[model samples]
Every structure is written in structure tokens, then in C-alpha cells.
Target: MEFQQTGELEEDVWFDDVDPMLLEPSNNLKQRKLSVALVDEEGTDGLTKHVAVDCEMVGVGYKGQESILARVSIVNEFGKCVYDKYVKPREKVTDYRTDVSGIKAHHIQSEAVLRKLLALAMRDIQGQMPISRTFQYLKKEIYFSMTFKEFKDAYEPCKKQVEGIFLLGPLMDKVTDFRRWEEFQDVQREVADIFKDRIIVGHALSNDLKVLFLGHPRRKVRDTSDYKPFRRLNKGSKPSLKKLAQVILNKTIQAGQHDSIEDACVAMKLYMLNRKEWERSNKSKGVLKQTKYFCTNDSKSIKDEKRRKIKIFKIRNLQKKRR
Candidate 1:
């Protein structure tokens, strides 16, 4: 799991180049293609090995019905704008969409043009490097110390420990809304910049990060939206952040479309609140006829607990024999 600066493990991790759902065939997309390419600015071969992309779309209805991909932007490993294009969807741009995406029909003459541009841009970025090379490049450029999987696995237990503390709130309409998940090109860069070495707390942050396209070396995200620890451990029915807050935090938090930052903050708060207990008792032995050597929440099953207790007992017995 440990990621070296330049090594085999770093090269082995894989991530998707582009989301297929965005490329769905529609009346507007069939008409044209919208894409762009990166060119060498200087004498140097400006083929940046990594890419980050995001897209914006026009939506129908009050809560975003029939969302149509409208705009996309891509940045290379060097933080240079390698591609950007606007796509015209099948339907007319609604007034509300106009306010959110800042895109109108006039922005894109036709969907055909957008399709061509997008295709061209995809070709250009794809041509720059092979899939294997691109992944290797991302490993070196985006993360440090450990591979994505390793980082995520190591943090999973800790992530679950504080699940009770994190919070989830309604998604907002601001610039960083999750609806714009497709339109976020600088995802990794922005998150790395803001939360470098810091744990990201949120309800169902995995979904947000996936949607936003922010991948950390470690899945340093905490999600409280679901019942599972960080929405993974509860293993029971899926619980909403609002409900979890009422039950765990004993307060009301969010209603719909959970906000990432707010949820992150609440998660951190919850972790802090419960962290003291773990810190105090993480090593404490069970009191008064309790045979367990570790905390009950530490292990999942009774069998596992029994195995741990046996090991603890063996160590204690060995110490006694030595004495």
C-alpha cells in the first residue's frame, strides 16, 4: 500500500479516463462533436501526463430534471488548460439553468459543433499518453506515501470510528455544489490544496469525491450520510445524515442534497467529540469480570473478539512465566 515516488506499486493503480454516461447519444450530441487538444507552448514537449476534467449541464424541472451536458473543461498534469468546449443539448436552456451554468443556446451554435470539439479534445488528450502511462503519471503527480487503495484501506477503520460525529446537510446552490460534479476539472488540485494532510469529513463523501473527480492517495473522506461507518460500517439500513444527527449528535442538520463542506465540518466535529473516548479507552482492559482485551467496537464478530482475547491472554501468560 505504501506508494513510493517512482515504483511498481505506484504504476499498478487504475482510474477511469472519462465517464461514459456523459457521452450518451442524444439528438443534440449526434449533430456535432466538441473537443480540444494541448499543444507544446515552448520547445519542451508539453505533453502533460495527467488530466482532470469536469462538465456542466442544463437541467429541467425544479430539482434538476433531464440534465443535459453543456460544458466541459480539462487540465493537464502541469495545471495547464489542455481542453475546453461547450456542448449543446437537445432541449432549450431553461432560465434557472442559465443562472446556474451561465450557458445559453447562443453560447453553442449547434450540438454538432460541440460533439466534434469534444471528440477532438478527447483524441488529443488520449493521444498524449497510453492508459498505463497515464496511471503511472497520476500516481507520481497526484499522491504521495501510499497508493489510493492502500491509503483508503488503512483509513477505513479510523473513518468508521468517527462516523457518529460527522454531519450531513442539504446541498447548496453555491459555486461548489455537487451538481457541478461533472464540471470540476481542478478537483484534485483544489482539494489537495485545501485539505492537504487533513482528513475530509462528509456524509457519503465517496460519492461526492467520485462525482467531483477528486481522488486522494488515501480515501481521507468521511461520510455520515449513510448508516455504515462513514457510510460503510453500519451494515444496516441506510441512514440519512439528518436522522444520524438526531440520533447521534441529537440535532437537526440537513434535508436534501447533502453539502460536502458542511458535511465535512460536521464529520470532523463528531470525530473530535468521540475521539476522546477512544483515546482514553483504546488501550483500557475490560473492567469487573470482562474478559475482552480490546474495545467491543474494535472488532466486528464475537469469534474475532475471542481470537483477540486469546492472543492477549497468551502475551500476559508469557509475561507471567518470565517473571
Candidate 2:
């Protein structure tokens, strides 16, 4: 609890040196108004509530160009870790981005001993392991302890030495077949549940959201790098989160070994510093305005609506000709 307060104080200091003109809360007073209602009828879940989210991704695909989410962290406005987990991507990982992501296969690797214990637990539950092992539908938990020698014997990630830099070798056949692993599916589902519907605030949020394959309304996202007030500070281009924190707050962040929770904490703090003013300005942003929709459940009704619109267009054209 004490740590939370100290951290908040530090965040206040992060922005203390920014130009006073940029921090004027009164700048948005003219735009303040009641925001559009978060209607349940729209079926939007987690609309008003805010949760700051950040993701650390590993590179995949040709020459490690494509990004895949490796880890995700989320925090509420209070600077608490809501969720943090290592994810196994559906595609094969090509680059771990160890310098920034600080993630290695061992961090998320399935321990052989643990897997053996888990197999035992499943066999105990069902009286027999499923002979059909094409899919690892079996999911179970077990606790154990073993000597270091025993652990080393059970697991080894092949490594290659090159010019003083060690690189991870190709994943074993079983590791590549991760889709069959129940834990992988579980991690994906669990993370998606927390992030998919919530108001996700972050830095470089669009990229993070893309990697996660999740969507939140633009109005619901607070992106530190793109905030209008920071345009000059960022030179009208997307700047690094580290740059923004350093330039505006005069505090350095992302120093080493990216900590998702810490990144989320800073992003949330940045948003909170200008929350009232930002929301007020957003009141008039068209993307933030809710639109009325004529929704229907029936597919037949959708077809009828389209047909009616076309027929009405023809009728209007004939009327114009007659006139």
C-alpha cells in the first residue's frame, strides 16, 4: 500500500518539468459535457471501465519481421497488476527479442517433469491416459520438487554459439506442436477474456491491439504516444514510450528487460495526469460519439431491409423523372 503512494508521487514528478502551457487542465473546460451513455443495448461490455494494457511481442515469420504476442500485462487505474501471463503464439516464434522482451523459451517451456506429473494426475482422474494423443486435450495440475541434477536431466533447450552470442536452436518436434497443448489454449482464452471487451489504455496501443487480435473502441483507448497535447513533444510523429516519458516527465522508462506491468503502470499514470482534460476534448471527437443503430437479430430481416432500400431507391428515381 505504501509503495503505491510512492509510485504515484514519482509519476507526478515524471511530468512536473513539462511546459506549463501543455498541462493546462482549463484548456478543455470549453469542451466539457456529459458523454454519450454507455448503452447495454449496444451489447458493448466493459465500456466505461478503464484498464491499462500493454503487450511484449516476439518476432516471427520471414526474417522475424511479423510480430506475435509473447506476454501481456494489464493494470487498473490504481497501478495494480490485473493480469500478466506468458503466451505461446499460434505461429512459430523466430525471434525472442530477449533485450526488450526478456523472454526465453524456458520461461514458458513446459517442464518435462511437470508434464509427467500432470500425466499422472490425468491418469488418476480418468483411470487411464487417452490413447488418442493427437490433441493434448488432457489438462491437469501437479506440484513437485526435485534436485537441480534431476531438473537438468529432464529439460534442455538446445543452444548454438555464434560470435559470443548464444541463439536458441529449433524447437523440438513436440514443442512445435503446441496447438495440442491444453495450457496454450487456456492461456489464450484467459487473456482474451480480460482484454477483449475492456477499455484498454497503453502506449503504441494500436500495435499491441493488433498482435492480440482484440478490438476496443478508439474512444476507449488512451494511447500515450499519440495524445494530442504531446504532438509537439513527439514532433507530430509516433514516438517511443521511453521518449515520451523522458521528454514530458523527465523520467526514463524501459531502461532494460521490459516489464509489462511497469509499462502499463506508466501508461496509466500518463493517462491519469491528463484524464479529465483528455476526456473533455474527446467529447467532440467523432470517433468517440456513439451512433444509433437499427439492429435486428434475423438474417431474413437484414435481407429484407437491403431489398427495401434498393426498391425505394428505384421508386425515388422514377418520381424524380416524373417531376
Candidate 3:
């Protein structure tokens, strides 16, 4: 079906039957708020380095046996819990997903609150820092704004300088959000318009592109999911983020449920780990020249006594012999 998306949708409209726990715990509403002076740390600018988003859906069986998304959760790259919201489905909640999602019909009577919470969470994660060029969606589209060399340099951007938006699903296709295909289209346009030819670093990123409908060129995408380090020691279809995090970072992740912020950080760690190996393999330096020569093939070796040598004593002699 051809889906038409409009950008004029209200930012404040709420969904009915959304769960409250999906909204992240706000620091402002806490009983005890820790007070610490904002001090400038050395060699570090206070800015978000990455954004990770994961969706927890109330999957309901429909039309015999089909699953559908009912809710979602999002987190920042700093491993900070940011956005969580339960969406109210248009249809009745089936008996199957109640145990898994913990979201019943009673939980999401108010959609307005959930919508406000999500908008705030997105703003909170966005903060005041400007978006990096690495988040660019298309290179040619951005060329008029910035030079190709300038955009190319952004491919391997510094963590402190770029905001990496990490997603849990495949990269090639956009997820159906808010029970409205329009919402997905709007998000895609927004992302593309904001970030044009910049780098997108993630795991199994080919799938991510499939999910996002983004066409990331080779050398522009840093896919940790495809890279295999310690190949002789480990051989498989690339390790899971949870396993890699436990082994490399010495931390536990994807515990209880999956978090996108943690996933993004894990992807970055995997990329960094494999980057050293890539460098080692590509290490070649110093000046060099090229030369080519043809060798004659002989089936059998000639006896030394019967061997003879033909030599041109001078360049003129060689030219005369050729002539």
C-alpha cells in the first residue's frame, strides 16, 4: 500500500490506553534531588555522544496469527534511561501479550500524558548541542552545503563531536511507529533533512539500513556487527552485543530487557576493538616503484653443457637486434 505522510501532525496529541511506566523517571520529580555544581571537566565538553533507541511492544495476535507493535522505549548513548511509552492499540488487547508486556487495557486510558512524556524525553536527549554533520543522510545532498572532503572527513568523527543515533532493528527499513505509517515517514524525512552525508556507526548496520530505508555507502558506514576480531580464536556469525559487552567491557547488558543506549555503546566498543586490527592489516608505508617482466616457460631443464646465452652488449646493439 502507498502511504502518504504529512508533517503537520500535532506534536502534543496523546494516545489512549498507553502505560505510565513507559515514561522515564524524571529527576525533577524525585523525592531527593542531588545538588552538584556544574564544573567544567578537563578535555571534555558536556554533550551527548550517542543516542540508542529500543522498542518494547505489546504484540497482539490479530487475524488468525499476526503480531503488532504496541509500545516502545528509547535511551541515550550514555546509558541513561530517556524515553519509554506504552501505546494504546486501536483494537482490543488479546489475552496472550498481557504476561509479556505487563500492559493491559487499564494501563493506557490516557494517551495525552504519554505523548507529552515522549516529546520531553526527545528534547531532553537533544539538549543544546548542534547536530553533527556525520548524521547526514545523503552525501550529494549535503555537498552544496559542505565540501565532499569536509563531509568525508566526518566519517570517522570523534565521539565528543558527533551524536550517534543507534537503533536496535535493521537499518534498511523504517519501523512502523505510532500505529501510523505517516509517523515513520515523518521521522525519516526529519532525520534525512537534519543529518545529510555524515557517518552512521552501528552493528549489523546493513540490516539497520534495511530498517531505516537509508542507503549508507561503503566506507561511510562503520558496521561492528560484520567485523570479526580474533578470528582464529573466535569464529561465528559475530557475537551478540550482550556477550561482547560482558567479555570486552566487563559489564552486563541486555539484562531483563534490551536497551538501545547500551546497544549503541556496545556497538561503538566493538568497532573500536576491531579498528586496531583493520589498521594493522592496512599498514604499508614508504616510497615504492613498479616494474614488470615476462618469464619464458620451459617443460624440461636443459643440460649445462648444451646451454647458451644471448646477450646484447649495448643499447644500440639491442636496438639493432630488434630492428
Candidate 4:
């Protein structure tokens, strides 16, 4: 993971000769390939505990103004993808933002596809069942009645149909690697668990954490965007990851569409390049506490804190009136 300090940075040396297709998305679905890689479980045993993460969002809600997580990527200290999955948004996606997010309709399971699969499964479970009952079963209530055997039987035919659809052309190649979350909350919980005990490195990580509705202790976060040295590189303002990669790494990124894996790798590389100095600086500032905790307060704790502050404010007012 270490790069040699040279007068001029070479693209291959900086990027480890990454495939261009991994950074840029192809308009043709057939040409696009999922760049997921398996993490070496043993490799992490003696490696740095820092893991970099990045998220790509699709537009949800009215007029595509709200952003929701569509894809998330996490890279280990060695810059290998440990986790990467496309998320099905709770709200309907109004825009895929293909130009920026690189997420297309095929990247996630669509409502039509879900309904089709459900219909096929229901038909198998309830032979000659009324259309009304079939539709009712599709409404999330059917899972209660169906046993694992029955569900698997129902899914068998649907699986074949899905395979056939894939063989039909571009869809087969494009969707073969499609990984989606049935419930958005499941992804949130899983991501929170993955980050619970590790140092997270990223750029503009606050935005990702906000969307995930999770928090990590400040001491465990290494945000390149918020780093003082990186800020200075951008003339004291918060620098973009793209800019940092271009200037610091001497490589181009985000030229067309944003790739979470690429972004995660860039952030991790930046952290690795300055790992020693970064840790020392944080230690000197007394912010490098070795505690495995998230910055989440329970509802009761929050209410208690609020009441305590209010009571203190009232006491101060009473004292001023007495004076």
C-alpha cells in the first residue's frame, strides 16, 4: 500500500494499474462489469485497522431533490473491496443520476421486476388461487403463511424465468451481479456493524453517515475532506476527493461518473500516505482515544440532557433576578 516518493508520480504506480473501466462507467450495459472483490480474512489479522468507505446516491422524493443511498463500497487497509452492494431505496427513485452516480435502472431491482417475481412465487404456492388473493399475498402478508419449503418451491420457477431473462441479451450480462437490499434498514444495520469497531476513512464522510443514520466516534474517523493538510491543498476550503486524487495522487478520478470503490480506494490511499503523521497529530491533539464506541445517545439520555440544561438555565435566570 506504500507508494515511493518520486519527483514525478506515475499513474500506474499511484493507482497500482487499476482497470480504467473500474473508475468509469460504460453507457452500454453489456460492457459494464461489477468490480467486486473478496476480502482476505487472514490479511486483516495484522494489518492496519483503518477501512475506507464511500457511498453513491440516487435521487428520491419530489423532483429528484432528495438523495438516498443506492450503492456503498468499503475497502480495507490494502485497498481491497470488502463490501459492495446496491441498495433498494425505501422511497421510489425518481432519478438514477446515471451521469453522476452511474446507477441505472438495471442496477437495482425495480418494482415491476419485484411484482413479477412475487406473482410467479404466489402462483406456485397457491395453485389456481384467485387473482384477488394473489394480489393480497403480494402485499407482504403472504410471508407469514408461507413456510421455507413452500417459498423455495415458489421461487424455483421464478429463478428460471430470471435466468431466461438474462440470456435474452444485455440484461443477462448486466444483472447477473446485481445485489440489492430488500429493506433499506437492513443495509443500515449491516453497515453500522461493519464500522462499529474500525477506523473509517473517507471524504465528506458526514454526508454518507447522515444518509445511513449512523454515527462513529470522532476519534475513529479519518475524513480526507476535513483534514487540515488536505484543506490547505485546496486553498483553505474543503477539497473535493476528485481534486485530492488529481493533485495528491497525480491521477484522474470522477472524470465521467462516480464509482464508490474508486473513491474509497482514493481515500484509503490518502490516509495510508500520511498514516504516521496523521496518527501522531491526532494523538498530540488528545483526540486519539482508543474506545470502541459510536456517538449515539439513546432517547432517554437525550431527554435527560435536555432537561438538565433547561433546569440550569432556569437557575441562572433566578440568580440574576435575585441579584
Which of the numbered candidates is closest to the native, going by highest TM-score?
Answer: 4
lDDT of each: 0.39, 0.57, 0.39, 0.68
Compose the digit string of candidate 3's lDDT tens values, residues 167-266: 2122112212223222445544544443244444465554433333445335344555544342211233455666655555556766664544456556
Per-prediction TM-score, please? 0.30, 0.54, 0.38, 0.59
Query: lDDT tens string, model 1, 166-276?
Result: 111110111021232222345435534544444444444444344333444322333344312322212233566555555455555545433223333344444444444
Between candidates 1 and 2, which one is better according to TM-score? 2
Model 1 misplacement above 4 A: 1-183, 225-235, 255-261, 276-323
Residues 221-285, model 2: lDDT tens digits? 67887776765454345567777566545556678888888788777767776788778877866
Q: Candidate 3: TM-score?
A: 0.38
Runs off by more than 4 Å, candidate 3: 1-182, 193-195, 230-234, 279-323
Residue 20 Cα positional deviation in candidate 3, in Å, after optimal superposition: 51
Candidate with the larger TM-score of 1 and 4: 4
Model 2 worst lDDT run, 10 consecutive residues? 134-143
